[model samples]
Target: MLEKPVNEAPLADVTPPRLEIRNLHRSFEGRAVVDDVSLRVMPGQVTCLLGPSGCGKSTTLRMIAGVEMQDSGQIFVDGKLICDTVFRVPPERREIGLMFQDFALFPHLSVADNVAYGLKGSKADKRARVEELLVRVDLLRFIDGYPHQLSGGEQQRVALARALAPKPRIMLMDEPFSGLDNRLRDGIRDETLAILKEEDTAVLLVTHEPDEAMRMADEIALMRDGKIVQQGAPYNVYTRPIDRASVAFFSDANMLTATVEGALAMTPFGRFLAPGVPDGTAVDIVFRPQHLRIDFDRAGQGPVPTPVDGTPARAVVERARFMGNESLVEFRLDHDGSIMKATVPAVFLPAKGKAMWLTIRRDRCFVFPSEGGA
Candidate 1:
């Protein structure tokens, strides 16, 4: 046999994506609900489909679950075509597990029976699967109990066990923990995440809550108007947002408007670089409230500028309130009288009308073209 070339490219993996969507589209009465949306999830990874209501997040999930048909594009599992314009697989045979907001447990069935509902095997095999999942979810003691006998969290766990009993390769969760009590929601969500990861199931969770997506997702697909505006890891999606709306979606934003003269937009804070932007362009400088640095006005003068903080801006406290974890101070700018907010940790409740100096981190701020600007 000939010696292998030293620089030969490595062969691609024989295993394909556990779930993949390619330019999926759906419409209703000429309105495009899900337009050319595509995404992929690998084994044991969790990808969150995050967006406001009516943005097609759930519709996309429905299409993937094989309940809703797409108008175009293809769905694939392990490189095998599952759904498209003409051909499709049955939802029950898709090997995908589903967990919804409602536990959807059968009231008449026992916990063990509910879990064994989807399993295909002899009686002994089904019972073994049910017992295994019940132990994993810590509900083995409830084996003989009916769904109505369990608390909200316990019922949800039983639902989770039922979904996992078949050992699905992909799990589609649609706000599964949203209905639980606040105290139980976090714990159940964490437990479910741990179990899914342990089972090596690719999870596609749909939720509008940013906190859930940030804490639970390995990847986030931010959808809007039937299109994904950005997709990335949680850190990148939050810190390196693609546009102004993207920033506002994750947190409250304070925007300062200025026209670019020479690749810089001047504000009371300082001139921020607008690299590659035209000289005559109008831009908006946006920063989160937590990025604002507050200091007492020293003898009616703001502090000197620094490279890290850019420049100090003067403002008067319009309102201040204690928000438990932090104090929020609203200010009216001295330069333009525009309102902005600052959040300081701890119990800081400054009197209204108090004058203060504020500085902003240039690196923490984002500059985007002002909406509707030429």
Candidate 2:
């Protein structure tokens, strides 16, 4: 008999998710805080829990860190059950590191001592680990200095070093970069991500800032009203949003209302295909500001229609502002007199009341069934 090929050999190298949560639920005063939240973060991956305030992002992190007990559901680390409704693991015993906005460094202890706080083993081992982590964060020279002697960014580095000293399987960071100055935030974020990736730790970071999430996350979990509405790669979540709210969350969105007929939604510019939506259903056609094209008017008439951009519509510029990288121009359409916004990649600030033709890229727009409409 011929030897059978073993499929398990190739899959053996495929590492399982380092952290996993299943159907996690928490409620406050009969109000659901985190409802049926489920997600997974693989080793060396940075997953950001992104949303506005009061979205239960912090609560989810707290639960994973074993600081807050989930009302229901299970938490797993490397496929091992750690916590659920009844079974639990103490925060200290969970092998999970936490870095919050506040550095929370020991005021009385030196940098070396702070980093070595969670470490164990012989004195020499602890000292070596402390020195190694301090070196990683480029704070080795300040090992003997106390927390107050350092700046906010330095303190954050120390906090990160301390958190990683124990080699936790999962790291929970709640807006750790929020306290740093704008100039320092980017640099520190890059450095921290590099260090965490090197350590192969699964990081679950919580932040309300979309830019931060887009910059740092390998995967983004977009939460709203205590539930995750969408989760995917940053580009996928941004480009292929599931709903109007998801689109508006990332950037300025231009929307127009229309009713579906023959699987198409008609607008002033053109028709948008709303496949799967029933006929006679009201829908919203949405597109980002960048997708709207501006053109010069020709004797009060706009440009002819094209396959990709559909039709050009006449509009009057209401306002224009050069926002460093791009220019934002708002207009009032002549057909409907409704406000619409567009962005130019360069400085092309037209004066207010200037007449301009507008066209939307048909391929870039999204059509969704209107909320509260059948």
- Candidate 1 Cα outliers beyond 4 Å, as residue runs: 1-10
The 10 consecutive residues of candidate 1 with the worst lDDT sum are: 9-18
Instruction: Give the deviation of candidate 1 from the true structure as CA RMSD.
Output: 1.4
Q: In candidate 2, how many Å is residue 28 off? A: 0.6
**lDDT computed for candidate 2:** 0.93
* lDDT by residue (tens digit), candidate 2, 232-316: 9999999999999999999999989999899988888977888888899999889999999999988888888998999888899
lDDT of each: 0.94, 0.93
RMSD of each: 1.4, 1.9
lDDT of 1 by residue, 149-238 (tens): 899999999999999988898999999988989999899999999999999999999999999999999999999999999999999999
Top candidate, metric TM-score: 1
Residue 78 error for model 1, in Å? 1.1
Q: Per-prediction count of colliding residue pairs?
A: 0, 0
